[model samples]
Target chain A: MVTEEEIESVSKLVRIKVADHREHIEKVRDMINFFEMLDSAGVEDDELVMDDVPVSRLREDAHESFGGLSGYVREYRDGYVRVPKMD
Target chain B: MNHSSIIRASALEYVRGVTSGEFTAEEFLSETLSRIEEAEARYNAYLHVEDGQKLLARAREIDRGIKSGQKVGLLAGMPVSIKDNICMRGSRTTCGSRMLEGFVAPYDATAVSRLNAEGGIIVAKANMDEFAMGLTTEFSAYGPSRNPWNTGYVPGGSSGGSAVAAAAFECVASLGSDTGGSVRNPASFCSVVGYKPTYGLVSRHGLVSYANSIEQIGPIARTVSDAALVLGVIAGRDEHDDTTADATPATDYLEGIEGGVEGMRVGIVDEMTEGADPEVARAAERAAGNLEAAGASCERVSLDMVGYSVPSYYTITAAEAASNLARYDNLRYGYDLPLDGYEFNSYVAEARGRFGPEVTRRMILGGYVSSAGHAGRYYLKALKVRAKLTREVADAFASSYDILMAPTVPILPFRIGEKTDDPVSLFMVDLNTVTANLTRRPAVSVPYAVSAGGLPIGIQMMADSMQDRTLLRAARALEMRRPPLPEVPD
Candidate 1:
């Protein structure tokens, strides 16, 4: 049920630059069609299960500095992670 | 100890051998390391094995600990393999993806920390599907892990390598993460025991996220007692992962494992075995009959919601993967790529292309299903199905069933490359295993029978949440009654 346009849009949305998303449209459609069986799942009145934790159970909102974390950055200088140009 | 005893011994036997001076830990590990090299040549089960010298040094220390009569630890000197996604401090945890190939974990996962604390030797990091996105190990960026039972056939995955290593005796036992049958699927194919604990029973702090809500770190071992041994070490509360259930630390899983299934109510899930391969369906029926003979009452039970479980599982996992994987923008840790002239959008888009085809498709589907325009029909409805499914399983347990049983997978292992192109066919492999994940229950796969072609089949048993001990005892009971299983062919 998915079109090539929708496939391209989703690829872009996920930050995956599939230059030819048309090539994948058929397989993606097949997967979606498989997933569409949920439409007939007979769960119309069921509420989604949420793992709700009480505020008391939540850990104290204290932030502890994790040493050596910056070292994991691929490109790091002067306590900052380097990235490609924003624009 | 002879080479056969050292290589093929169960985890407990290895511990007993080492502690009772039947052999030294150094001797056991040396033999295991040598066998690992041979097994990897034949099956490609390991992603990485630690340097022999380093591994031996640890084993020697354990030997000294035992000699000096110091309090060594519970595991003594048994070797265990970890699925690659579970972080071990300073180990290269690739997660079977090119994206993190060079990423050395900075700190120990709670489970790994506990394993080390208990004197377990991490012999190797087992291979898995990339980001744990596939049912089979074929999606690994590196080559797939072949089944030890039949080299031409696949070891079911994403924990294929864990099961293969355990089944082939590369390690005495191994740890695998079960998101949707990753552990049990391969264990079934490899003829080993795989146990997925109730959600939150095992800490998820060290595991790379696929679907955070449903996945758990579990053990794959040749025997149910060995799996219980490892599970006892890793299953407990941790300050690191708040999602951990309120349970005693290092709870004894084997204390009552021989309690037997006498007078227990067993439900054989009908939907899980309908249309299964005749051999597999017959195996489930035989398993039920065996349990009946062992004094557990068995009957056919219908689970209507299981029909919708696979699609719902895929939908929810896809969405979560998209969100979880958004962290890999290449601004941080990843493989080397030049960053000259390109802007942020272009840089990240190109960087993210390193993902495997299955991961890419899930990301796309994840984005589409979670999008505002389609959420009502796809993402939210999938959640409803999950809730409904959970309720159905819980009701079955509450009313009449002390445990539920089914064939771990609906079919026997096929040769690799046979079902790679068929996504739906692959999804069905998780048919019986996903209900445990979705409903937050504990499930175990016990190797039951081998097909005429020599493919291994496993019987799956599930129990209500927090009833892990009951599940283990039931699995043990079945393990005791099953016909003898043949050795994995060399």
Candidate 2:
């Protein structure tokens, strides 16, 4: 079983706060234990190449920015984005 | 057409009636909205139904266009539901998550745009699992969508609401995203036709991403023809999503779908059916027998890699979901939160607490597996297994079969809360469906049988990637031969 401290560490790494820390530790432990089945899958870590698209299939390198997008920023004030007011 | 028949009509039927002056689009909209008012209360199928007045006004516009012989698109004001994860310019795309509960979308998804251009009326936003994470709608932050067949039982999810909307006649069709069988699972439970198109067949530009690599926007409808009709509208190349196929396969998927599956080959995947309930297992066999009667050969083809498909699929999707969902840091596109007396990281962490338990759990697993210490043991190994599974499926497709058949789910729909506590058991329900997602194949669930207790059973048919047309034909053939289905009870 994973320690609660380990769960806290993993949560910090992902920047999530699992409310019932102990409960989630149990759930996540079961998930990791489920993942352990991959060990016997008889697969080696081969070079990763899958669903590959050739470079010729790539779109043109041109990039255009969305113009006049401030209207979309729900909290936009003038030209600046509104942040939560600091204490 | 009267109100009941208007509500019950299929997508194509609705279009034909509206176009040929049998029923106006406004009449159809009013009847459909009335049906939703009655049914949505029992099923909880819609997270947000569009404003009835506003929708009726749009329907009136379409009706006028039809009256004047304006260039009406194919759909002719067909009422359709969109799963909440797919953005429409003005609707709240909540994704069944409280974190995004108030986030109205500013742009339309490519699929939504296509459906609208073809005159499909967006009637409601269907419910789903939070972040499209769970196998049952029990994980929905709002509430579970019940099966139309039995309100006490679950509608299989995370496209549960989409299936229910279609099955209960609340909408003509629905668009749902399928990652690891979200669309087909619910369709199986609700006695609807759910299709997951080949990767890149439908553009995913505005879909709220849970697992980008494997997910595709698909249609859930009352029949195979309705699914194919919606697929024809929303499929094909899109400049916004480069991943969409450049040489579009066929925009008219409904064109030759009546082509019978005579002299076709189907592989009944042994891994998918070996553990099914006896009745479910028998249904797969019965479907095979039907195909055989249609002059198609049916045989068991075992792909051992499928045994490992679930773990690989979950692993890859978790990693992608963690990355895809990291943007909801409470700053850009999230519900409001107070930021007083806290540092940046701490404030953001506080806000992210809004994520439901399932999404949080996956993100944690995602972080651990992709972290440096565990990457070799979990993430990379899972990818290798995914590669092996893909190759194995590819070989089977190339060397042996035209379609693969299986029971869409391993068991009939359970009670809503029956399997929520057992995550692994819930994951196992996806066993028969994930091979299609992992291999990026086109798959469909055709409602095949009804259990003795009145639950639905769907027969899943899959084909090689981009063989959606062939897959649809096989599904239609099965639908034609199956026993007459019971109507969803009032």
Candidate 3:
């Protein structure tokens, strides 16, 4: 079972400050729930030979195809793709 | 009016009309801009919408080219919205995260470049879950993208904005990425068609990675034909993306639009149906009956290990995510902390601080799973389980089923904030769709049913790995059987 301290430790290890997740009760509940589900799953390990473990795919080599202004405006602007910055 | 009719009126019909010399490309672009303006206030579907002055200029240019007898691109006049994660050189690809707020891309993703090359107009940037992490657009740093169908509910995400924009006719089609059903879930919830091509079928050169192994750039459209048309513009191999395979040829998916499923074999997954809401199950059954009536053969199939897919996907995705997101640590030009006394700690602290709750939670979980000590027990075991699951699906295909049919989501879209507080419940929402992602297969979510209250549900279609065109063809055929969707209620 996941303990309150264990959840906090894990959360800290991952670098997230769980501001208000003060109660570890639900956290433990989820862990127990997760493992309980897994415990009943009797999975088997088997190997099957399939067509290609790693198959090579051929792609057409083409360049610089722009349909119209709608396409261009949708893609280009700013110094790059615009996204919100974290302050 | 139904979205299909509007599509016919403004997009397809407009194109046909232009061909007949009744109007010009400029006219269609103007109408689309007008529609986007009309719906923008309530839907919150777009992250950014250009004033159309520049787009109109291009439309006029295309119109002049047509009049001058110049050969224009196939989508010469259609306007398309782009999910924010895919880069368009010089535009900010936010990935719906405040961490990268105002982060600009140095270049266009392969798909965006292809769309621009084909003459399709880029209308706007659509909103989504932070880093494409959640099923509901509610996780967006920008705010939740409302369902065009029901503003009270969400447009399924992390491609929620794209789906809503498409469903509400804000754009003819939009580009979205699906890793663990980002595109399909939104499409399902929004009542439109969202298609994820087989893994590696489309180049991922410029898509901001969520889960690199599973993420695929796909299309969201009002109709299957539009989705297929957009896929034609984007699908291919790019040398920059080594994971792209050389196994199959990309076909003109439009050719398969009218090709009825004469003798194709469809597998109805019992696992996908069990525990699904009655409305969702009935929708799948109804679609199956329609296909059978149209000359396709249907059979029930069992995926005994299917239940493990969500957890397995989570395990594997978290591991990969830890590695992929490592770059966001305020370095080399992503969101960076102001370089002060110490760069390293500042960057690390800033990244950890700025990332949303869901993003931070998953990254932490991912790091933990891939940690040296836990690697074997969690990550490695999950990979082994994935291999087994993939093999099982391959065997199922080998047993004669061409595609697996199921409900894209087991339930209708939920109200905003209904389950965001409960991360586990939110994650389980993708249980039915994650299997396709884990197996690296192609799938589509087409609107299947409208509830008594009028919310839209979707039917999912999964094709074997590398059979991207075949899946599109089947979905297009099924699209013909579904009803035209009505306008999303406020």
Candidate 4:
């Protein structure tokens, strides 16, 4: 079972606040226990199949004009997205 | 004309009517809009219906083109609803989350653009589970979409509204995204035809990411041919999505679809049927029997790795989802909380807090599985298991069968809140449908039988990866054999 502290640590790592960490801890524990079923599949010798497209065949990087740039960014000034201060 | 009849017409019928000038596209759009308004109050299928005048204006152009001897595109003003996760330029594409509540998309998803280019009219944005995480529409921030068959029950989700819109005749067809049975589950629950193409067959560009590796935009319609027609339109290589294969586009999915399934080998997945509701299992068996009567050979096929599909599916999806959804950090496109005198982390936390419970749970679990220590033990192991399962399914198809069959869902549609409390129970409902997503194969759900309680049960048919047309042909054969289903009454 996952402890509340572990849930808190995960929440911080994921950058999402858990409203009731205690309630979610038990639910998360139950789900992890369900995931434990994967241990029985015995895949130690299996070779991973890489289905992704090869990088060599990729299209050349080219700029395409999009008219909706203003709609996509929540806050933009002088064609740049504005972000909150970090320090 | 009865507005319901016009809405209930097959997508092909609508296309044919508009292209041949048999009925003005404007008249058809008005009837469809009126039916949507009538059904919206009872079924809650649409999150946002397009303005009737805009849709009618587009339809009027198609009619004028037809009269002017100019060839209109294939779909030619056929009305369709898009699941809200798929971006349509200038429309709010909320994925049923408060995080993107007021966010408007600047560009259309590839499928949306294709549908528009083919003259398919976008009538509404359908509701879904927030971030496509839940099995029932109950997780949607817009509230649950009620099953048209019984307003008290849930329309299965996260494509619940898409299925409901098609089933209730609010649209001639609808588009949905399937990651682990989202399309097929709702299609079964609502008695519509849903098709989940092979993972890369349909481009994923402009779809709000859930699990990048597993999800694909699919089609929902009232009939098998209509689903195939829509699939033909939305599928093929997209320059934007590199994951798409260099395969030939299916230009004639409706052609020769009525050809009977003679000499085709059908496998009834033993593992998928073991613990399914008796009615669901029996319906699958009945479907098999129907296929056999159509001269297809049927047999039991055992896939030992099938049992691991659900766990592997959830693990991979959660990990992918955690990575895919991390971009909604309030800085760019989604709902933002003011950071007045607050730390950057706190602002992000507040913004992400807008996610519903199910999305939060999945995201948290995804983080847990992919974290440093657990990555090797859980995430890596899950990938290995997924690899093994994919190989096993490929081997099964190569040696044993041309197609596999199973119940689309394990049970009938439950009341809205019946399974919401137990998250595992909801995950279990996806047992039969997740394998297709995991294996990256094509699957379609067609309504096979209705329960004594009058709820519809659908049987899922799967074909090897990229064999989507074959699956549709089999579904069409079965659709031809079954008695036509009655329309859900308003």
lDDT of each: 0.89, 0.89, 0.78, 0.87
Q: What lDDT does candidate 4 reach at residue B300?
A: 94
Output the better candidate (2/4) by lDDT: 2
State the lDDT at B295 in candidate 4.
Answer: 91
- Docking verdict class for candidate 4: medium
How many angstroms is residue B161 displaced in model 4 relative to the true structure, after the best TM-score fit? 0.7
What TM-score describes the B chain of model 2?
A: 0.98
Model 1, span B84-129: residue lDDT tens: 9999988899999989967888778889998999999999999999
Candidate whose DockQ is highest:
1
Worst 10 residues of 2 chain B by lDDT: B331-340
Each prediction's RMSD to truth: 1.6, 2.2, 5.6, 1.7
Error of 4 at B105 (Å): 1.0
Candidate order (TM-score): 1, 4, 2, 3
Better of 3 and 4 by TM-score: 4
After best superposition, candidate 3 residue B324: deviation in angstroms?
Answer: 1.5
Q: Which ten residues in a row have the lowest lDDT in candidate 4 chain B?
A: B1-10
lDDT of 2: 0.89
Write one digit per residue (lDDT tens) for candidate 2, span B1-490.
Answer: 2247877888888888888999998998898999998888899999999999999999999988999989778998889999999999878889998788567788899999999999999999999999999988888989999997999999999999999999988899999999999999999999999999999899998999988889999999999999999999999998777789877786888877888889999999999999899999999999999999988999999999999989888888988988888788676556567555767777777777778888888888888888887888888988898888889899999999999999999999999889877788888999999999988899999999999999999999999988888999999999998989988787
Expressed as tens digits, the lDDT of each residue in B171-287 for candidate 4 is 889999999999999999999999999988999999999998889999999999999999889988988888887875566688778877999999999999989888888888888
- Count residue pairs with overlapping backbones in model 2: 0
Model 1, position B349, has a per-residue lDDT of: 87
As a whole number from 0 to 100, the lDDT of residue A70 in candidate 1 is 70
